[model samples]
Target: MSRKLDPRVVRTRQMLRDALVELIHEQGYEKITVQDITSRATLNRATFYLHYRDKLDLLYQSSKEIVKDLTECIDLSFEEDKEFDFLSDKPHIVFIRLFEQVSQNSNLYKVFLTEKNMPHFTSRIKDVLVDFILKGINHVQPDDQLLTVPREIAVRYFAAAFLEVIVWWLEKDMPYAPKYMAGLLMRIAIKGPYVNNPF
Candidate 1:
């Protein structure tokens, strides 16, 4: 059995998270403190202590929520489909939705992802992508004997490529629309590396 968190508590935590992200952008993650977060959130120290022990605790929880939203963004786009349609434009649709999620929350991602001292947050996102890709690979090709490359290496390669594109997108302030970026990623995913593609 499980219990739902109070709505007030949930709202408070989100406010704190948003405040922390704002402060992180202004100063940096390593320099921000719990007091700074609470002050920016317009809440007091006692209220902050009631929810999180410290700034780092808030950071981990905030980053986890972002990753959860990203996972749900991708998952909800394909919940009705039991089988993947490789021949169809399904990859583009899914990637567009995923990128839309990031663009919608671009500020938080721009700060946490680009920050120098936030490797933990970045790694958590990569871990999510790696797990998602690994599961898909296993589902599509269940037989290990048929694999040309080690499963771990292949999965990491795909995950790193996806992560790098996302970072680049953020760095460039998402000059390309989500759908356009999705099409590019889908092509690379289906046709191997960009250099080998006929396009």
Candidate 2:
């Protein structure tokens, strides 16, 4: 069995993560320092050091945590008993949950996705999406004859498009609700851009 984390430890880590995110928005990642994070978090250097070695370590751990949460959310959509029909009019639960998660954590995502200095973090998100797509393809077991292009190419294409759409949605201040976005993505995924036209 897994050990439960102390509530105090969780709160301190969240504060540090929030401070780092705020600092990244106000200035940028490269300009922020360990002292800057502690100051913003209203904690001292010793408390910060107790959890993270430096700002980079904090950023990395925070990013990984976010990605892990996302993976868990996505994994729920693939539960064996849940029948997810991509072609159905209804949006997949995974997309709804994924978008909701992103909306809830918009600030952190905006910093990770838009900041030029955090390409590695952005790439990590993309990698998660790619893995998600691969699992989906494996689970669904679509006809091989239907796929004209290589599976790897198709997976990357969908993953990149999904990631870009997220960046666009966040950049635009999330004009649409998460459920609406989820439905839209489901529609697009089921029927490509030229739904009525011949390829």
Candidate 3:
């Protein structure tokens, strides 16, 4: 039950987001000021203030919108039911959808994932992933059985690894296609690294 926003508000917000992103790239987030964003967006200081309390508020809003869209896309693409099987192709499909979403928003992903200065953005994303991973773990585990390793540890391990790989891919400008990366991720998820096996 969400109310629709005015079209003008939506347009103005998008303009501000685009301006902020452009400014961030040019001078980094720390150096960008409210005046810079307002000028870039063709809006006045009062208008910017009306929509956002400050520059950091604008940044949080932008980051939240991106994360919310990503979460909804992933959840809708990989809905879980009583019959849903985690060990089947569903996880792979989810991973593929994730990579596709990231590829679609490569500019924003590059800025948020690889930018060392944006720790808050990175932490927020990790928090989202950890929640999803915890749900995934429970989905895969039996109701009566307990995991040998703590659930939080396992969730954090996979979440951190996934984020690290994402950062690497973004930093390298996505040398591989999304499909190829998805395949590799699926294989690793199933077989894991063979580090302990004898050569």
Candidate 4:
């Protein structure tokens, strides 16, 4: 069984996370000291240490939380046998929601994604996406250049594509809104036959 977190503990951690997000936007992660975070959070060094091992550890915690929330919003079961278009809509909507949250503090996310810590965040997202795709499309076997790729391969491809798109968006100062991006990315990722299958 899992233990429930204390309300006070949860609140304190969120405060620290909020502070860290704010601080990262103003300066590089390498340049932002622990003292800066503690000061911004209005908490002491001991309190910061109690919640996280260090700055890097806090970043991991933030990434883990985002991934967990994202995975939860996804429904793994599809007993109704959804149409491909139906499947496309789900990702577009879900990703838009995540993107909206990211847009709240774009600069913070920009710093996080481009920094050395990217691999940690990228890997966590890839693992979740892999598990989601592998379970949903377990038997996707194409017979052309769109070959019979394994579920793991599909996940990796999806994750890689999304990461590239996201990095570009961040670098571009996020010229488009989340809804526009959701639609555009859906077009790129909606899987289908290599040959025309407009049935």
Candidate 5:
């Protein structure tokens, strides 16, 4: 049902996105102009305008693409009929794929996640995680009697903690491998701070 995008258009947009990433790294998002992006992309102002209204428009669209890719990664990892086990020692495929997605796009993630100036993008990422967690909780159907805290609060807490840890991993140059990080996240989610130690 969806129309196919022209290859030329796709290539041009990728160039613009790449240029934006490079410019953001060199200077910062606030200082980048449309001219800077076009120049970096080796394209002209007219061509740039044909695709986007302005730098912000380009940023929003590029970010949407990244978010879409991440969503797809998570979606693909979920098996519709199979329930995911949270207490298992093994890392979930969803977490593994999520980490792999971030690792593959580390540069873009570092810019988006660690940049204090880009709170909008950071919040967008959190929203995605929150939505995923809510859906996951519904799918798992845990008994309400066992939960000491409110479901919404727990969901938000987990989402925020997961996002912060990812930001830390990125800022620290990802010393751990994606698979290892995935397992660590699973352990933390299952046992909280008591993952390896027992009281």
Candidate 6:
């Protein structure tokens, strides 16, 4: 009750993702079509639809694939056997790896980081960050009810803040070094909001 795709299937999917990425760089995501992607990728229209529903699906899959790879490469879940301040270091280290990924392939990440019209990535980012926040919170406060309104405010704001900061960093014409920016990001994220809120 299983299936393994042929090697060609793997290569074809990669081709589509790569082609779509190139096309996105040349033109905005809104302007891209399935036909355009397939043509550039040297595959047929049927092949394109068989693999991806549309340009947006291709884009989402590509971003997920890239981030999953980055996540796997980094050891974010180190054991805290000693007082090494890994909590403080976590986001900064992740930021370094994330932005280093961007630096290596800026064009690809630009498409991944902020393609405003695409809602798929919006959900993906929220899901990833929410999970991250829950993990950190559970580790620190295992008995707390995370679903409460007060808790949601902090988790939601924290994730949104991190994403906005990252997007701003990426969109900058002169990119900051990811390691330094990561440290700065982690500091604020761990510290929570600066101004008071009556929530």
lDDT of 5: 0.85
Best by lDDT: 2
User: Which ranges of candidate 4 are over 4 A from the true structure?
Assistant: 1-4, 78-108, 139-154, 191-199
What number of backbone clashes does candidate 6 have, counting pairs of residues 3 or more apart or in separate chains? 0
Candidate 4 per-residue C-alpha lDDT over 169-191 given as tens digits, one digit per residue, 9 for 90 to 100:
88899999977776666656664
RMSD over all Cα atoms, model 4:
4.6
Q: Give the least accurate 10-residue stretch of model 2, judged by summed lDDT.
A: 76-85
The collision pairs in model 5 are none
> In order, what lDDT does every prediction score?
0.83, 0.88, 0.80, 0.70, 0.85, 0.68
Candidate 2 all-Cα RMSD: 1.8
Model 2 scores a TM of: 0.92
lDDT of 5 by residue, 62-156 (tens): 88988989888887424463866677777878888889999998988888777657788888889888887776666665677677788899899
Model 5 stretches with alpha carbons more than 4 Å out? 76-85, 195-198
TM-score of each model, in listed order: 0.83, 0.92, 0.82, 0.70, 0.90, 0.68
Candidate 2: tens digits of C-alpha lDDT, residues 1-199: 9899999999999999999999999999889999999999999999999998888899999999999898888876465635667677788777898899999999999989999999988999999999888777666656666777777888899899999999999999999999999888878866776658794
Q: Over the stretch 1-199, how does candidate 1's per-residue lDDT look in tens digits?
A: 7799999999999899899989999998888888889899999999999998899889888888899998877764343455757656546456788789889889888888899999988998899888767766676677878888888998999899999999999999999988888877776766666555475
Compare candidates 1 and 2 on TM-score and give the better one. Answer: 2
RMSD (Å) per prediction: 2.9, 1.8, 3.1, 4.6, 2.0, 5.1
Q: Model 3 over residues 31-138: C-alpha lDDT tens digits?
A: 999999999999999999999999999989999999987787667423345565544534456677778888887788888776678888899888877876776667
Could you give candidate 6's per-residue lDDT for residues 81-118 as a string of tens digits? 23436356454344566556656656566666676666
* Model 6 stretches with alpha carbons more than 4 Å out: 1-11, 42-50, 53-57, 67-75, 78-82, 86-95, 98-106, 140-149, 191-199
Separately for all candidates shown, the number of backbone clashes (residues 3 or more apart, or on different chains) is 0, 0, 0, 0, 0, 0
